[model samples]
Target: MTDTDLEIFAVAPPGLEPALLPEFRALGYKDARYGAGGVTMMGGWADVWRLNLELRGATKVLARIGSFRAMSLAGLDHRADEFPWDETFYSGTTVRVEATCKRSKIYHAGAAIERVERALLKAGMKPSADGEVTLKVRIEQNIVTLSVDTSGESLHKRGHKEAVGKAPMRENLAALFLRQAGYDGAEPVLDPMCGSGTFVIEAAEIAEGLQAGRSRRFAFETLASFDAVDYKALRRAVSVVKGPARFFGSDRDAGTLKGAVANADRAGLSAICDFQCKPLSELKRPDGAAGLVIVNPPYGGRIGDKKQLYALYASLGTAMKTQFSGWRVAIVTSEPGLAQATGLPLSQGPAIPHGGMKVWLFQTPPLK
Candidate 1:
């Protein structure tokens, strides 16, 4: 809320940096950098709204309100009050505060939240009785920083996949992996190991140019001074295109495939996607056009037994080599050894963090 352009922080699962960087760039955010769990870019309150409405791979977008040196509770209180809370939070709206302290005299996180809440109350806004609209605070190296979260829930909840199968990949991560696999609305795409069809669903959405944030509401809408006109205009400009970039998802589990079909239908993308029950060992190239094959196979620790998982990976590798020629391949796995067993000539892409495990995005060249 200061005269200076706001510093916005966007968080994602780690290895997704490569795929997410392009999305930031496409949004005209040039001065941005990646961090351990997310990306930071320079923008204003408007950018925060745009990001919440547009970014497909981002988990949460935070508006960096301010940062200042604070050594004690008094210093924290003064800094918290200095921010123009009235300009952001409305009198009727509810606000929740959370804090983290490191190596600071005001080490008590509860004390910091109380100070922040007092400041907001003084500006005429009440704290949420139910603890909603969370404001994330971090104090490190004696500097206190405050951020307003724009996405109330994580952006990965696309609201369509209600019945996910075992070891389901998140929609945000699936979109990032597909982009990292070079899916640019050109060729057909295949997710041979697609469990609940997240990858294929995302691919269909992207190919049709549908905005991922359209079906969801962002926390930014709760702000007192938020301009709805711009948001409405942006949404109006988003339209789905009809094209030939077919998306296909298959799984050995027929029940999961049925769930995938239901999910795709619920997403309004059944026309653009094909879901079927097919084992990886029996996967064959589609007859018409070349495409990219992306798979989020179950890593051993998460779902199936280790021996079965290793055999699955090996058989998947063999099937890809024999059947999916001239097609690009990308596999998301936490186990390097399992990825190595794929037998594809792979170079590590990016290291992303998901579900407390470090996931690697590995890519193999298009078959000759």
Candidate 2:
């Protein structure tokens, strides 16, 4: 493929590919479709930059540069040397190479990595364990696929949220979960167990039409293909439309609420986001039109005792039933029983891996 025509992959947490695809499609990637662990589409370097800046559900964006078949380490080195690395990477750029082999004659990943590193070094690149940019080599069935991690840090960082609470939901996953719950920034959003204000702040940012990567620097900036002038113009062209929906969050832990407020302020969403110290039992629907109530509660697996979490979840259910009429609800928890304890008419969604545990999103239609 030419420099202007390249394969772009948006990596997401396993099982969230479906949730991430619509985002690319909505952003004008008509050919975008879900893959095993993410979504893949064909575009140039500019698309790579835009995806890194705009995709909220992606954990990172990978640019599939090129690939070749290599049955042996010697062959791998030969092919790597033949490939045009100078086209995308600048000499002396610090990089780390990672490899995975499956059902391939080149079974040793270390050997494969060494071959690739040697080739890179021959091309004037510096190979370091602590490199800022990563090159992923996947050899499956004797076919090698080369991809660069265009996002240096995970996209979840968002370069904001200076503080985080215990077992906080990541920003990318929170955005995808909000989308899965049918939230589109058109209605108010409430998170009763808000920790660090990830959900509320993400919703507020989405409502304000803020760019996901506005505050961050991407790995693509170091690549030879990057265009600072073009990227700056792209960033400048994104205009924010202040949505009318208000985002609210509450938690019994006053200290956590304090941090959440700080996070909202850092995200520049404090104007539309309201944080308070309150328990689930004290949760009341906002005065505005009904919207979405999304929460990530303690499931015994991570934070609290299972037996006690059921009661907390039950209390959350009671609050929604009594006060949040016509508002949709989504609860993220590891235990199906904890979600069932909510006792709301819920639908269990695909299991998503989070913080060393598997969690599912349990949602409901508008509460009658």
Q: Give RMSD to native, each candidate.
A: 2.3, 1.6
Instruction: List ranges where model 2 is wrong by over 4 Å.
Output: 1-4, 237-245
After the best TM-score superposition of candidate 2, give how far the Cα of residue 315 lies from its true spot, in angstroms.
1.0
Give the local distance difference test score of model 1. 0.81
Give one digit per residue, the lDDT tens place, for model 2 in 323-368: 9999999999999998998789999999898888899999999999
How well is each residue in 128-232 modelled by candidate 1, as lDDT tens digits?
645557778899989888788888889998767776988789988888888878888778889998888888888888877777787778888888657888667
Candidate 1 similarity to native, TM-score: 0.92
**Any residue pairs clashing in model 1, and if so which?**
14-352, 14-353, 15-351, 15-352
lDDT for predicted candidate 2 compared with the true structure? 0.90
Error of 2 at 314 (Å): 1.3
TM-score each candidate.
0.92, 0.96
Candidate 2 weakest ten by summed lDDT: 236-245
lDDT per prediction? 0.81, 0.90
What TM-score, to 2 decimals, does candidate 2 have? 0.96
